[model samples]
Target: MSTSITIFDTTLRDGTQGEGISLSADDKLKIAKKLDDLGVHFIEGGIPGSNNKDIEFFRRVQSLGLRAKISAFGSTRRKHSLAEQDENLQRMLAAGVPAATLVGKAWDFHVHTALQTTLEENLAMIGDSIAYLKRKGLEVVFDAEHFFDGYKHNPEYAAAVLSRAREAGADWLVMCDTNGGTLPGEVHEIVSAVGLALPGAPLGVHTHNDCELAVANTLAAVQAGARHIQGTVNGYGERCGNANLCSLLPTLQLKMNYTCIPHESMAQLTNTARYVSEIANVNMPVNQPYVGSAAFAHKGGIHVSAILRDSRTYEHIEPEKVGNKQRVLVSELAGQSNVLSKAQQIGLHLDPSSEQARKIIDRIKELEHQGYQFEGADASLELLLREATGEIDELFTFESFKMLVEKTAGGSVVSEAFVKLNVAGESLYTAAEGNGPVNALDNALRKALIPYFPSLRDMHLSDYKVRVLDEQDQTAAKVRVLIESRDYRTAWSTVGVSGNVIEASWEALVDSMRYALLGLHSPQPVRTEFGQRGLVNH
Candidate 1:
């Protein structure tokens, strides 16, 4: 069996069909460059006939000199239309790309109900389109849309569709589970049967994630003799998603030993996934296989302890292989090993058997019991670690802060905050107005500290969340606030808990500023107790 597999990425085309995913021509071009850098075999840009943006992308993409062949996606001409005269086919030719992906109806039900055409006519459409594209000297990939469902319903008609495409010189025959409802066992069996019947034809597989088995099904198909695999980055697509190439590429090369992408380009997988998510304005799932933030994160006491001795005890593959690093998260469940690992991760030195390490572990459990979570709040955890070790000094001390709200007769409202701080023994005061109390407080705090710590100018809160610990306490319930702050270089998160939401926001906001200052300036530790107002002792 040939080990070389063709990777077909349909992110720009089918991935855009996902909810809330919109990419301009420029965005598509940028992603295409990244995909080329990662060494994918084919990039399905989009259907040029459907949108002017895709047409523009093709025109601009030609100048990029990418290694991957850009494939223009479209259907098999039209139901009753001639291939040469079909507008969609003409657009593909004008796209000026080297490849074409033409999806045609393989299901008899779709042919009858959706296309409202005869089965023989659909076969003719498939044959004519592939032959036309072949004559034009473009590599043609015929996507047998709904092939699995069609095969289950009528095996003969489905087999006829594959035969027509094969005889028409289609470079690849891709069996698609269009509805995304095929099981892995069924996919393997059907793909095996097709490969046997088709003889020398190059078989491919395209699947969806409706059943959440798209990746499993694709793997099964590959095991059954399919070579070309179609998927989207981060699994973005119409319904649940398409098969995720982010997960597929690694599994194929590292586990299955299938030659898919360049071995050196494998490390770019996580970056590519994150870059696409950044451009698409979507949050990459933290638990996403291989690339997610929490993919290699060890939090359990035993897991962290085992990983410290030998990472293979807890990790399947080395995280660095995919441009991700193992993270040791500290929480109530953390042991001495977790603390030691996390301390090392942050460039802090702490003896594993020392009383300081035990104290820190006990303190984390104590804080977590008070509704403070440190797993997602790395900056806060770092600050706590430093404080425990007596390394962090007070850059500034908070004296008092207040918020004011006003409502007019016109139904307009305004929020303002006043902050007083002791910076290097100088009592400084500032005030700012914002759309909300938290925003106003953040602005005011930044105003008071920017002069002392100029790095505060680049830092801004990116995300903030408040989780109420006890709904039974209603409005009086304590809330845990997590604040994510980012400067030009990196981002960090901090946590604070209080019965008053504003007070909780204040603690998190202070920790964010303190963490930023610790990186640039080192001073003596401040007073180490919480005052009556839950403020750090000055």
Candidate 2:
């Protein structure tokens, strides 16, 4: 068995089988570049003649200049057809890619029943398809579709199909757990047999997550001598999804000592997973192994205190090894270390024993007990910590504001808001209209601040979320608004809670602006009864 493995990512092909996962040709090319930069060996671009979008992807990827070979996926010729004259094979050659992966029926159930073909004819089809592709001088990878189930029922026929592809000059005999029912022990056992059956031929495994063991099964195959690993980013695929490369690659390189992705590029694993999730419009699984936001997050007070002295106290490995950070999740359940660690991350050197730090932690606990969660609102936490020390400058103050709504002749309602701010004790007022009440308030607030703080022009709200604190009160319940804002460089989150929805939104928006202004000035850290947090431009 080879020591180094090939990383084959099928995000553009099998990954699109997932519901709600779709990508344009341009999106496909961009992701392919990211995968190449991460040092993956092969990328399955998609079947050329399957869809117009896939056809366009082939055309666009031709100029990508990637290190990874872009393989086009298709199937063997129909039963009883000449391989040279096969339409599918003809398109595969026309794709002009370096590699071709063709999946054929290795299961007798699919052959004798689905295609209604005899066992002998199916073997002939597999051999002819591979031989024809080899004659065209293309690198061929034979995917033994349903190989595991086939071996369980008709072991002889399953072994025969793989041998036929090998004899016909297929470069790789890829065993696929199409139904994903096979366990890891079974995968290891079968891949070992397949390796012996086709001596001198390279082996590979493709798996699904129907049993929630795609990653385990893929690793098991690698343990049993498979060299090329097939998977998708964040495990995005049909049904439960394919083997997750985010989890698999790290396991192979860091644990098993198998060489896959380059050691230096491993740090990019988190960003790569997040990039694909964003383009696919999928939420990042917070607890996903290695790359998730909460993978290395410490929340318990006991765990936080120990991790402050030694990160290995609760962590298995340094999170930075995978482009992730050790996060001290501050909540009502936190202790002094949570406060000190969070402050340290934002460039604050706080004296944990001091009154200001204790006051900040106490207030955070009180607010969270009242249903204000701060895990996603660390910028708000920073503002509170600085404010408690009297170190934060008051950039703006509320004087008075009014909101108005007007109904047009077309049955559309328009909202207008006017905001009054006391800037340097001078009254400044502005009015603006928007698609909704929150938007109008945001516009009016920015207008009022631009004259005094023009840097607010470069900042804008990126995301807004609302949660009801007391659902029993229904419309009268206090609503918590969390707003994420970004300037030209980085982003931050702030939160607020109030019984009135508009008022809650206004509070969060104001804090977001204040944090941005504070970050811009980067005021010096000062010492008092407690140490202060430095504003290092966030």
Candidate 3:
């Protein structure tokens, strides 16, 4: 049997059935072009006759020049209607795709109750729909909706539907777990029987992740003679989800020796998953298989050390193969290996046994002991390395600052703050008011330095987080604040710890601005004979 399988991406069709998923025609067209670039064999556009957005997508997508075959989806014709006159079939043809997939009731329960039609009538609907599309020069795919559950309830009727579609010229007969409750073993056994029942009929599988077994069931169906696998990127779909192509594609190619995409396009799989998630406004799962941020992250000291020696000791495959980089995290749980690895990555050239290296390691331990974790503040750690080694300049030092708040008659609160900075042997003072005390403080600080550094306006704080480190002193507990700041080019995070929340936030904010300036002037470190450090322009 051929190991290569056709990849049918349904992110636009069944994927939009997800609860909060709404996409415009332009969004769907962009996604179709991306899927084509990713080398999927077929891309399923939404049901053409169902909505206005899908109609426009079918019209706009013709100009994209995508290499993949765009397929339109719809249900079989209405009961007792002529195939040529059916609105669904006519709309599918107007969409101008080479292939059209039609879903028909496979379960007797649905035919007798939901569809309110006889089994023989449902069979005729499937056969007539496929025959009509085939005569229009379109390759037809027959989706046996609820196939697994239907086959168990009425095996003969389900097999008869597949036979009718095959006789009527359907190119691929797809088995769908519409309710998403089928087990892997059950899917394999039923698909195996179906393969035997309809000999020479091309078979495919479509599943959902209600039981978290969509991927497992799809694999099982493939093992039992299914050739085409339908799924969505990052598993976006109704209910739990569809099978995740991010997980399924790599697993099939790397573990099972099956080919689902062009070899050169395999590396783009991770980026494709992330791109779709971004467009859908879905956050990427940190621990999702193969493509997540934490998929190959080494956090434990032991794991990091082993990975440093031989990546094969802790990694199942090379991270680069999937376009994800390995992350060596340094926190309270890290060891000397973590420091060495991080320093190298940050371009700090320190001998592992040197006094400077030992100082950096000891300082990190001491700070983390006081709840100043460096795990999320790599930029701050790099700043510390430069400061300790005298590779950086003393930009500025803090002076006394004060914040005042008042309540107006309308129950509105107003706040103001003043900041004084000792910049280049001169005192710079500024004051401002804002919606809150923190915002007031930020405004005052930025105003204080705008004269010395005009580029300070380009950088602003993006996120701020504060966590109380001690519950023992409820009223006076120490707080840790983390601030993320970004300029036009990149972003960085800094952390601070203190008993007062305002003080902690101020420290983190200052560090964030200082780091942002450092990127602007990346001066080389100059060492003196007295073991002092200074910066020299490179």
In order, the Cα lDDT scores of the candidates are: 0.91, 0.87, 0.85
- What is the lDDT, from 0 to 100, of the residue 148 in candidate 2? 97
Q: Please identify model 3 stretches exceeding 4 Å from their true place.
A: 385-519, 522-538
Error of 3 at 506 (Å): 4.9
Which ranking of candidates, highest TM-score first?
A: 1, 2, 3
Write one digit per residue (lDDT tens) for candidate 1, span 258-298: 99999999999998998899899898888999999899999
List model 3 lDDT by residue over 306-339, tens digit each.
Answer: 9888989989989888878787777767777777
Best by lDDT: 1
Give the TM-score comparing model 1 with the true structure, all chains together: 0.92
Question: Model 3 TM-score?
Answer: 0.83
My TM-score estimates for the predictions, one after another, are 0.92, 0.92, 0.83
* Of candidates 3 and 1, the better by TM-score: 1
Worst 10 residues of 2 by lDDT: 529-538
Write down the RMSD of all candidates, one decimal each. 4.9, 6.0, 6.3
- In model 3, the Cα lDDT at residue 17 comes to 86
In candidate 1, position 47 carries an lDDT of: 90
Model 3 RMSD in Å is: 6.3
